[model samples]
Target: MTTDSSDLSQVDEEAKLDLTQQIRDAILGGEFAPHQRLIEADISARFDATRAAVRTALLNLTGEGLVERLPNRGARVRAISVDEAVEIVEVRIGLESLCARKAAVNITDADIEELRGVRAQIEAAVASGHLVEYARLNQEMDRRIRDIGGHETATRLLERLRAQSARHQFRLAFHPGRASQSAPEHIAIIDAVLARDPDAAEAATRAHLEGIVDVLRHLD
Candidate 1:
């Protein structure tokens, strides 16, 4: 029984993706600490995947900035510095404020209602101490905001920036009293967009991100 070459190639691709997501989840879930080495052999063994798949997965994660590859050293979970975090927040502020301004012009009443619903779910997640759910909802909220803005280029840029910020943002969400405090900020951004106030929307988005950065500074 000979396996087709194309079928084997597809299987390899699927294996790589599966391993990639597994490692990415581990890093995001704090199962793999920042700067912790990810030995390819061990990961391949653990996931019961080939070393080639594990290497491809690590490389994909490196592109996402969730993992780093050193010349002599193997891959490890990326450790973002305070300065890098600040830069990420700054970029997000610029992009998100623009997203809000555009959304103010583009969003419909129905979109606003949907955003409110998502925010409500986020609040519920927080109240229930479902940190993972909250993180997922938070990302959904951001995507909705970006889509509402109707800017393809900006949305793509914001997506990359958000990917860079994902781990820090997730950790920040778990900070003491953070989830409760964040609701009003999210609401403010939604309200500004709903009111069709671009200036207010931009200001609200900036303030919300600035607040997160400020809190992160103390937490750091």
Candidate 2:
């Protein structure tokens, strides 16, 4: 008996999401290096998925800025140009600083405690050398901080930039001592926010992004 078209469509969508996540994790985990070509046939073979499913996954990744597809060159992990990298940092500096400033004004005691809890988890991840977990916690902390601003527009923009930012952060987190150094920086921001000091919170956010920009500048 033939399956319904809707059932077939649902299965296809699930396959695409699964493969997209796998490819995204691989790229973010450095298995798929920046600018590394992604051959459809190879990916299809490795994942035991249909070429169509692989194509859809690649397209989804491309939308997320994790994959790039060129006319004749096919797909590859998206490589940020120096200019693009600098621009991303500049955008982050603006958005995050604004979020911190607003968070300082609107954040409640509960917010501070929740943020502190996440910060503690991040510290634990750092101490244990769980680099991946640290990155995930760090991202969560940033999201929570942004949510304190209560500005949907700013938060949405930051969220889009964050996906691109993750690629850089994943690479940066791997460098010796990077995660350790970043932990205290986050503490400073948390402290400023907890104190409801808008200026200090904004400055702390800017300083953190500046440090990231410096690191990106030195990368090959």
For model 2 the local lDDT of residue 205 reads: 94
Cα lDDT of model 1 overall? 0.84
Quantify all predictions' global Cα lDDT against the true fold: 0.84, 0.86
Predicted model with the maximum TM-score: 1
lDDT of model 2, residue 145: 88
lDDT of 2 at 17: 97
What is the TM-score of candidate 1? 0.82
Any idea what lDDT model 2 has? Answer: 0.86
Q: Where in model 2 is the C-alpha error above 4 Å? A: 1-18, 45-49, 125-133, 176-180
Summed backbone clashes in each candidate are: 0, 0
**Model 1, 146-168: lDDT tens per residue?**
99998888887776666666777
Model 2, range 132-202, lDDT digits (tens) per residue? 89888888888888899787888877766766666767778787788878888998998899899999999
Q: Highest lDDT, which number?
A: 2
Angstrom error at residue 81, model 1:
2.0
